[model samples]
Target: MISIRSVGKTYRSRHGEVVDALDDVSLDVREKEFVSIVGPSGCGKSTLLKIIAGLVPASGGEVTIRGRPVREPFPDVGFVFQNAVLLPWRTVLDNVMFSIEMLGLPGNDYRARARDLIELAGLAGFERKYPWELSGGMQQRVALCRALVHDPSVLLMDEPFGALDAMTREEMGLELLRIWEERPKTIFFVTHSIPEAILLADRVVVMTPRPGRLARVLDIALDRPRAVEMEFDPRFKAYSEEIRALIFRPRRERVH
Candidate 1:
C-alpha cells in the first residue's frame, strides 16, 4: 500500500549546518500490512513517518501510496500523534465526530457510526465527558477512535501509547488488537518498545542511528489474533531479543 524508495531527509540547523536525519531509507508496506518501526532515539523513525504522511518532504527520493507520490496528506490517511490532541472543551463523542464535521458532513449522517466507534473503542459511557475528565488510557482510546472515525485506508501511529502507565499501555495494546480485527487498515506504527512492536506488527523494520537507514526487516512468524498472553511465550521473547540486538548494534559512521 505504501512505497518509500531511497528517501532521505536533511534539516538546516540555525547554525547553518546541514544535518541528515535519514539517508537512503527504502521500505515497502503491503496492503493491510501492520508494520512497526524500531530504532535508536534519533534514528529518524518519526521523520520517515512524516514523509510518508506528506507532512514533511524528504530531501531526496520519494514516498508513494499506491503508486502516487505523497505530495500532500491523502484523505485516506489517518495520523495518531504521541498525544491525543483532542480539544479539551469538546465531549468525547464530539471529538470523535470532529473530522466528519470538518468534511462538512451532517452530524446526523455520522452519529450512528460515531456511536459504534465509541462503543468499539470501549468509550461508550464516557462520550459526554471532556478529555481531562477521562483517564489517560481512556483518552488514548478516544484518540484512536477519533483517528479511525473516518475509516481511513491507512493509519499512521507515532508512539500513540508511549506516555501511559504500563498496565494501561498493555490494556490499550489489547484494545488496539480488537479494533484492528474488527476494522483492519494498513498500519504503520512507530514505537520504541520492542515488546509492543512484536505483539502488534506483521513485520518490524529496524533502523540505524542518524543518518537513519533501514537496517533489517524481520517478519513475525507468530500466529495472529495475537493475545497479550502470547507475550509470555518463549518465541515472543526470541523475537524481542532479535529485534533488540538489531536496533542497538552500532552502525558504520556515515561519510560526508
Candidate 2:
C-alpha cells in the first residue's frame, strides 16, 4: 500500500559539509503490514519515516501511499514521534482531541472516537488528567490515542516507546499490537531496539551506517498474536543475530 522509490536525503551541515543521510533506499510496504527499521544511530531510519509522512522532503526519489505521491503533510496519515509531545495545559481528553481541532475536522464526529481510543489505551478514567500527572507510559499512550483519533489509515511511528522504561516499553509494544489487530493500519516503525523491532514487525529493515542503505529486509517467521515470551524462541534469536550481523558488519555499498 506504500512505496518508497529510490529515496535519498542529504543535509548541509552547519559547517557547510554535505552529509548523505539516506541513499537509494527503496521498499514496498503491504497494506496493514507492520515494518520496523533498525540501524545504527544517525542511519536515517527516522528521516525515512518523516519523509514518508511528508514532514520532510526527500532530496531524491519519492514516497507514495496507495497511488498518491506524498508532497505535503498527509491528511490520512498519523505520526507518533519519539516523544509524546502533548500539550501541557490540555487534559487527556483534550490532548486526544487536539488533532481533530488542528485538522479542522468536526469535533462532534471525532470526540467519541477520541474517547474510544483513550479507553482502548487503558486510560479511560484519566481523561481529565494532564500529561504531568501521568507516567511516561501513560503519556505515550495519550499520544498514541491522539494520533489515531482521526482514524488514520497509516501510522508512522518514530520510536514512540523509546523514552519509556524497559518494562513499560514491552507493555506498550504488546498494547500496540493489540490495537493493530483490532484496527489494522500500515505502520512504519523506527527503533534501535533489535528485540522490540523483531517482536513488533512482520519484516525488519536493516540499514547500513551513515548514508543509510538497505542492508537486508529480514522477514520475521515468528507466529502472530505474538507475546513477550515469544522473544525467547530460537527463530527470534536467529533473526536478531542476522540483523545484528548486517548492521555491525562493514558497510557495503548498496546500489538499488
- Candidate 1's residue-wise lDDT over 45-129, tens digit each? 8998899999999999999999999989887898999988889989999999998887677889888889999998878788899
Give the alpha-carbon lDDT of every model.
0.88, 0.93
Candidate 2: clashing pairs of residues: none
Worst 10 residues of 2 by lDDT: 247-256
Candidate 2 to native Cα RMSD, angstroms: 1.6
Candidate 1: C-alpha RMSD to true structure equals: 2.0
Model 1 ranges with Cα > 4 A deviation:
252-256
How many backbone clashes does every candidate have?
0, 0
- Stretches off by above 4 angstroms in model 2 are 252-256
Per-residue error (Å), model 2, residue 29: 0.4
- lDDT per residue, candidate 2, 126-226, as tens digits? 99999999999999999999989898999999999999899999999999999999999998899889999999999999998888999889999888899
